[model samples]
Target: MKKTITIPLGSQHISLLEPVRFNFSCENEKITDVDYNVGFVHRGIEKACTEKFEYKQVGYVVARVCGLCAITHTMAYTLGIEHILNIKTNKKIDYLRILMLELDRIHSHLLCLAHTAENSGFEGMFMKIMGDRELVMDIQEAISGNRVQFDFVCIGGVNRDISTECEKLAFTNLALLDKKVDDLIGKFTSNWSTALKYKNIGALSYDDAFNFNALGPLARAAGAAIDVRAESSILPYKEVGYKMILGQNGDIYDRNLVRLKEIKNSILMCQNILSGLTEGEILVKFKGKPNGESFTRLEAPRGEIFYYLNANGTNMLQRVRIKTPTFSQIPGMVEIFKGSDYADAPAILASFDPCMSCTAK
Candidate 1:
C-alpha cells in the first residue's frame, strides 16, 4: 500500500525559514517535491532605490534589506557605487570593512546556531548558544554603537574609527567566547542523544551539494571548501590569512561542526584586525554619479550573497538586485527531504538555518 499527501508548507516558510511558501508533495510521510513561492515580504527595496533618495541616502535604505546583513548590504552597495565613481579606497579602509563584516558573521551565525538548537529540541544547548551569543552582540554594540543596524558605513569608507576602548571590549568578549565555545564543543559531542540525532540525518554527497550550489558553511560542511572570502579578496582579508573550514560528511552534524569551527576564525580575525590598526581616513570625499554596472559578493553567515548594480551617471539612475543564498539553495531542500520522514522535516530545515527576509530581500 502507498499513501501520498501534499503539505503546503508556509508563509513563514519551513524549508529555508524565509517567509516563502512551498507545495510539498509527500507520500507515506516522506516529501517528494517542494514547489516554492516567494514575494511574501517584498518591501520593494530595489524598486524604492529609484530617484527621490540620493545615493548616500540609499545606502541606509538598502542596509535595511536585512538587519542581520546590514553591514554586508551596505558594503556591497558602497563598493559598487565607488567602482562606478572610479574611487579607489585605501588599505586601511579595506581592513576596517572586513573587520565589520566578520563581526556581523559572528553575531549572525551565533543567533542562527541558537535557533537551530531550539529547533532540534535541545533546550539546554539552545540557551547555552544564546548565552555565548551575547558576547558577540556586546562586541558589535561596542564597535559600531548599534549591534543590529550598524549604520556606520558611508559611501567611500566606514564612518567611524576603531577606538582603543572599542578594541579592548571586543577583545574581552572574544576571550570570553573562547571559553564558552570550548564548553559548547564538549556538550555538543558528549550529548549522546544529540550526537545520534544529527549524525547522518539529511545527508548530502559532495556531488549533490555541488549540483545544489550550496555556499558558506553549508557547502563547506559538505567538503566543497568554496568560500567567497578566499575566492574573492574584496577586502584586506588576504592580510590576516584564514583557512577554509570544512567537514568530511555533508550532514546536519557537519554543518554544525563547520559553523563552530568558523566562529573561532571569526573571533581571531576580529582580534587581529583590531591589534593591527592602521592610521588612515575612515571616510573619503567623492564627487559625481556612477556610470556603469558592477557586482559585489560576500560570504554571509548563511551563505554567499550577491549584489548587482548598474548606474547611469545620475543621482537616481540605476538597477539593483540581490541573490540570497537561501533562495538559491531552496531547491536542494526538496532533494534532501524527499525520502526523509515527516518528523525530521523541521529539524532538517532549521539545520540550514535559513533566513527568509534575507532570502526574499
Candidate 2:
C-alpha cells in the first residue's frame, strides 16, 4: 500500500507573500488532494466600505484591497459609483485612466514573472525582472505621486492630470521597459531550463478552466478567450488597441508567456495614450448622493475584478461587494494541483499569482 502524507505550505511560507495556507495530501511525490485557507488576511473591507466610509471615500478604501492592483480596485469602485450617478467622463480622463491601468498591469505582470522565476530556482532572472520592474514604478510615481497605492482613479474622473514633464518621463521609462520585456520574452521562450521546470507542469485545460470559472491569466493561458477589457464597455480598451493574449498549453511556462506578451501589449497601449493624449479636464463634478445599485468590472493584473454597490441616497453606501480574480480562480487552482509533483507546487502557485488579501477581503 502506498502511504500518503500531508504537507502544508503557507499561512506563512517563503513562497507566499500574503497569508494563504495550502494543505496538500501527497501520495509519494505527487499531490493527490489539496485544500486552501484564504480567510487569514480578511480585513472586512467590504463592510467597512459601506459602514465606515462615505460613497466618495470608498474609492480610496477599496484601493487597499491589494497593493499591486490598487488602481484597478479604485477604478472599478469609481466606475460603479459613476454608473450609479450617471456621469460621463471626458476623453482625457478616460485616456489617463487607461495609462495608469496599463502601467499597473506592466509592473504587476513583471512582479509575477519575477516571483515565478525565483520560485523556479532562477534567482538571476528574478533579480533582472525586479530591477526592470522599477522603470514602470518610476513612471507610476512620476504620474501619481506614489508607487503602490496611487488613488489616482476616482468618481467622475481621475484625481491627477498628466503634465508634459510626466509624459516625457513616462515615454522614457516605458522605452527602457519595452526593451527589457522583449529580452524577457526571448529568454522565457528559448531557455531550456525554464521549459523543464514550467512546460506541461500544472496545466489546466479549456474544459477544466470553464468548469472552474477561471479568470484572468489562468483562463487566458488555457485559451478561454474571456477578458473583461474586451467584453466590457466600461473603459475605452478597444480604442487603445487592447489585444487579448492567449496560450495553448496553460502551464506555468504558458502563464509566464501570457504575462510577458501582456506586458508588451500594455506598453503599446501606454505609448498610444501618451502620443495622442487630448486636452480636457481630469475630474468632473457630479451632484447628489448615490441612490441605486450599480456594478463595474475591470481586468486587473491577475484577472477580472468586479465591484457591486448599493446606495440609499445617503452619505454612506448600503452595500459594497467585491469579486476578485484570485477568489474566483481558487477552484481552478486546486484542480491543477491534484496531479502535479509536490516539489513543483510552489512554482505552480506563484504562476497563478494568487492574492489572498483580495480574496479574503
lDDT of 1 by residue, 1-361 (tens): 4566788777754334567676777887877767767778777788788655767688899888898888888888888788888888888888888888888888778777777677777778778788888888887788788868998778888888888888889888899998787776666666764555788888877888899887777788889978888988677677876778888888887787778778888878887888888898887788877788988887787888888888777788477888887877776776888777767777777778777777666
The residue-by-residue lDDT of candidate 2 on 1-361, one tens digit each, is: 6588999998899988788999999998999999888999789999999789988888898999899999999988888888888899988999999999999998999999999888877899889999999999999998899878898988888888888999999889999888888888888988876655578999999999899999998999999998999998878999999998999989988999999999999999999999999888888998988899997888999999888889999999999999999989999999999989999988899999988889998
Per-residue lDDT of 274 in model 1: 82
The alpha-carbon root-mean-square deviation between model 1 and the true structure, to one decimal in Å, is 1.9
TM-score of candidate 2 on Cα atoms, chains taken together: 0.98
Candidate lDDT values, in order = 0.79, 0.90
Count the clashes in each prediction.
1, 1
- TM-score of candidate 1 to 2 decimals: 0.95
